[model samples]
Target: MRKITLTLVLILLLVQSLFSHLILQENTAISTTSQFDTGDTAWMLVATALVLLMTPGLGFFYGGMVGKKNVISTMMQSFMAMVIVTVLWVVIAFGLSFGPSLGGIIGNPAGYVFFQNVSVLTSWPLAPTIPFLLFALFQAKFAIITPALVTGAFAERIRFWAYLLFMVLFILFIYTPLAHCTWHPDGLLFQLGVLDFAGGTVVHMSAGWAALAGAIFLGKRRTPNTSPARITYVLLGTGLLWFGWFGFNAGSAMGANGIAVQALGTTTVAAAAASMAWVFLDKIWGHKPSAMGACIGSVVGLVAITPAAGYVSIPHAIFIGIFSSWVSNVMVSKFPKGKIDDALDVFSCHGVGGMTGMLLTGVFASKQVNPAVVDQGLIFGETTLFLHQLVALIGASVFAFTASWILFFVVNKITPLRVSQEKEELGLDLTQHGEFL
Candidate 1:
């Protein structure tokens, strides 16, 4: 009897060990599937901060270009954008971007309020190491700066209240849909294999075309003869913008990987090449290169590389930079013919540069750099990619321009789009704020 009891006890112990082993294997599999890494999380955190800095950098860039009288107002527009867009993004924009798909038109509203399905531990497919909230903030910066770009069109003219209303409507109706179409995983553009690695078409091109519409509707600044308030401020603003752009491009990689390194390298090279191209072009056309030329060239290059950063080779990036700068320069020179005084030349630098980059990307993308990219190459022989690129460029431009034009007209009809002529001469600082700098 004693022997039998001992044997039973040993059998029970063996069964318990077997169950423990199975549990251990299951846990290991779950951890491996999740696979969140420290390095990737750290990099995403830094990148998020970097993108946030670009808003103020843009503020300075736009602020410096406007007449001195409107400097404060220009700066205020950027500040307001940061605040207003952040609110909108948290409340609805984040949901519309990354929430469950709604037949590919927009994201579902289930997560619209944020911190619902999102938490410190929650991860997104876009950046698995980072919380969904972090990714949302990173994208919010893009949304903020885009509308700020439009302020250049009607600077020193539009009322603050009217501009605020326009931004709200624009964010909801225009920006959100474009973002959903281009960046969301199930987005039609993404499904169609349209690659906009960053925000070339979505951010820069959209804003540029909208600026054109605003300029047309608002009419020219009160005094077309006035010069920029402080060239020094413009130079300062330009430097900051150039510096912040590193994060803008590299951070798009969303991880600390070879792709991120490649993006950074290409972005730096493109900006340098374009700067030189602009300087040489200016010298060839007239005399010495101006600060304005250098600043504009750098920005154009940055804008151009935005979509192509991770997909193209370094050499291709250089070509894109030089080509985009030249195109933008030419466009700027002839902008007067259109006679729409886009005060800061958003259309020339962002609009033309973005369009040029998108087309050039089609020409330059290679399967050698990223074998996963399908329909690759233009010079190396794939024509389908080029055709797809053309379609994206045309589609984005047409839709953005047409929608913005109608929006501008509607806003103009309901409320005046520009400040009075007398107010313009005095400067926005005094007219709008009742305070002189």
Candidate 2:
């Protein structure tokens, strides 16, 4: 065990050293080209705070849903992401994402080392009304939350120390590259005309696929207790995620503008519609309407509209919410019989819902809402956007799944991922965290 741990650490250090000099290009920097707007800046500041809060909210959400013995361990996984991912972002993760382009696959590793050339005085061109530093921080909030989201799929079984190592590896390799491809200006997916209003492609889809990989790699829980610890916590988490989504989706506009307003509106309508739809679907399926059902449905709706919020209308968002909630609901219902165990249905709610949202965006998107939209959706008689989104869905999902699966597999070999059967019966709360309810 000691030898394997040492080997992993050494390999990590070697990779970090190699990456520092991977691709340095100073001449390709984007000059500050616009003045900052106080309103936009303030809105973004607030939005960043809101998004940051969602991570803790996610902890509560996951904590409540897991078995009592695993609750603390599950929530701690999210809290760790908030801490660890920020350190990585401040170091080099941010650069690998938003720094100068490298063949459209990644950013220059040396471009934003220690945020060298980045400053508060300058504005990010993509969001010219806000300081570059602010942009970086807002994006950091995103980097922090993604890995936390993946913790849901392998709640009780994972070893905490192994999980931490996996977080570092996953963030650097899987998450960073996906963010670069989807959000950076010169990225391959961006150049392909794939429109992700916020993170249907980057955040949700990537996290969703990675969650699937983790669940598959970790295998099913050894013991049988899978009941939720607290449904109220799920509701609270749902509310927080739903509320933070206004910032998550609208803040992507980077300014207090009509696009942000449109995103905010769509986000609201979608959650409402989806929650309503989910409850009724339960009724039709012979199950009584329940708070847990409503909460999960609402969140899936939020995930579904995240990619289309800036490009679609309220009515479109409603349709998206209704359809996506039903799809995820069906997945939750049927999956109990499946071999794969996605504990909290991360892949079902976020993965399938993200895919549903992305395809719906391709169908309903319009340049009228946000001129930055690459093109109109197929509803407006253009098929290019639809095709591009499909490519992005397949490409990003496959990349995340393949890379994460291999990473988990190798990491497990180095240090076991799933707890031993004895530890499994003991409960992670006591064994992992030395806590008990």
Candidate 3:
């Protein structure tokens, strides 16, 4: 009996040792899987900062175009988005945009509520070399700027409190669904293989359509159109926007790889080409080549190339720049001002430019540029990718415009969307915020 008991004790010790070894090995495997590349993490950090700068750049951009009385109000609208969206993202917006797919229509809000699984130890599936937390932060910058873009359409006439409510509703309903559909792996558009290198579709198109809805819903401003508040501010904003776009386009590559370099190159060339093209077009049309034209044109080019930045060659990017500039310039020059009051022509520059870029992406995308291109663009004699892109464009446009209009209507019911005629004539700065230039 003593010998049997001693044998049983030896067997139990052996089992415990094996179990401990297995646990250590499992922990090691998990650590290896979560290990992040220092280079990628560092680059993403810089890129997030770069993208954040674009909002202030955008604030200046929109602010300069409005009347002097509304300059602060216009800028405050853009600045406000940063604060509001940042808080919302930390709480639940990130989860709604990027959580586990809920049947591919939208992300499951419960998946990452309050950032449950988003941690330093976790890695996003697509951006495997970076911490999942970093990816979420980078995406938050994108969310911040989107609602800000819509402010340009209704600048100088919108009720401040009502506009704030609309921004929140738009993000919760309109923006999240579009983001989930376009970026998430299980998203309908992503699964359909529609490639938006950055945010040509997700950011520009949505903002553009929403701008149109706002312009139509609010009607024209009571005050007559006037010269920009400050051309110098517009120039400064353009410089900032051009500088920050490098991150906006290159960072979408999600790594410090050759693709990022290629995106940077295309972005630079596109903006330069577009700026010159706009000036030249103005000269051809018997109009003086104005500083404002150059600024607007460069922005349009940036908007057009966003979807194609990492997919097309530099030469193709130049064409996209010039073509999109021409299209937007014409739209701006000939816009039916009597029917619609798109202050600063947000729809012309962003909506039209984004559409032009999306179509051109279908025409110019090449597998040689990016391996992710399973179906080459139309130039490569393939129709499948282009067809899919067209379908996605139409689907995204209809959804954004209709949903945004409804949100506007809902917000209007809760609180008036447009300010009273007296407030409008008094200017948003003095009436809304009790300050003026």
Candidate 4:
């Protein structure tokens, strides 16, 4: 069975490589005429690298939280995404996500398959200030990390091959459509004036709800390992995520301008506020505050600020950070105590934080801060924007949750998702990868 799956994967990779070679040959002549700004181009180049770094940062964040026996497996999931998702994106996923709209639901895959027309010489029509190639690769990083985030929910037990299959499906069906709907020009949500400065809906909400679905479908672990292996790793990961986030959020402005400056400024304030709020929440609950608690708190803050990064002022950002941290800290504590084995609280931090941050964006968004703001937030006396945000949130949550659940069911039917009880007991590093911490 292992050989069959491995052979299939290799075959797919070979086909993908051939397609890439074809695109490379075709790409030589498809030079773009769009003039680019050096400042925006330079910023986007750096931003792309920073966003790509987040996946490895996620590896540390999640890897340190799993048991010693599962650390390599945990980290490898993120690393695998870095490898696999880039190829998938280059081949077709990017077109499915950002191609010309199809009824505001999906993009035309034929347009971008193998990146046939993607060009370094042209400024992206979407951003117009940066190279189209940079835009594609940057978005690819976002795609890569989102699925990697789901590994946290069922860590320590899931078969890696089953996971790779599910990752492909989820990226194609779930992540692509959600992104096209929310971020693509002429997308249903974009046309309706739903603002997502970064990827609250496309990344966090989708990954979070999918994590919830995986937990439900996979069932509980035989003996759940709740304690994290290394809090220091989590802290280190948090710092990396926080640093990369300047590029993640500010970079989303698609240029290094005042909006990017505002995003960078708000990102700092929000994370700091949330970290402090998290530790304080622990003390209020009669538990001693710890470094891990602060790290998680800070991440929740970063997640919450993602959607609101460019739309709100620093003060509102601070509130967003505190409120999101409080909600996630509560959920993280209460969620795992239940029957479900979301090993590392992916839903609690990413899902809950993303939703909270997105909704709050509607509360604090203003045209004064970002001229691109078509509708002011509820605080600016426009309930319409708030209502729009709510509807988008509900829509994204339902679709991601439902589609992911079905994908898990289908993948499980093809191959057992969880390993044998004996292999699982011995840990995935040895049984799955033949390596160990």
**Which numbered prediction scores highest in TM-score against the true structure?**
4
How badly does each model clash, as a count of residue pairs? 1, 0, 0, 0
Off by over 4 Å in 4: 1-31
Worst 10 residues of 1 by lDDT: 25-34
lDDT of 4 at 108: 89
lDDT of all predictions: 0.79, 0.88, 0.89, 0.90
lDDT by residue (184-295, candidate 3, tens digit) is: 9999899999999999889999999999999999998876587799998999998988888888999999999989999999999999899999999999999999999999
lDDT of 4 at 143: 96
Q: Give the TM-score of each candidate.
A: 0.89, 0.93, 0.92, 0.95
- Measured by TM-score, how close is model 1 to the native structure? 0.89
Question: 1-437 in candidate 2: lDDT tens per residue?
Answer: 66755785576567556654532344235465558899999999999999999999999889999998898899899999989888789778998999889998889867576565667777766887889999999999988988898999888899998998889889899888889988898999988989888888788888899999998888888754578998988889888988888889999999999999999999999999999999999999999999988998999999999999999988999999999999999988887625788888999999999999999999999878778776789899999999999999999889999999999988888788988989989999999889988
Residue-level lDDT tens digits of model 4 in 1-437:
57866886687578666676666676777656778889998998898898888888989999999888899999999999998889888878999999889999999876577777777786566698888888998899899999999999999989999999899889999999999999998799999999999999999999999999999888888878557888888988888898899999999999989999999999999999999999999999998999988998999999999999999999999999999999998898788545888888999999999999999999999989998898899998989889999999999999999999999999999888989999988999999999987
lDDT of 2 at 280: 98
Go through the candidates in order and give the C-alpha RMSD of each one to the true structure. Answer: 14.0, 3.0, 12.0, 2.3
TM-score: which is higher, 2 or 4? Answer: 4
lDDT of 1 by residue, 74-173 (tens): 8889889988888777666777876778887778744444334455555677678766666777788888888988888778888876787788777877
Off by over 4 Å in 2: 1-34, 336-338
Question: How far is 219's C-alpha from truth in model 3 (Å)?
Answer: 0.4
Ranking by lDDT: 4, 3, 2, 1
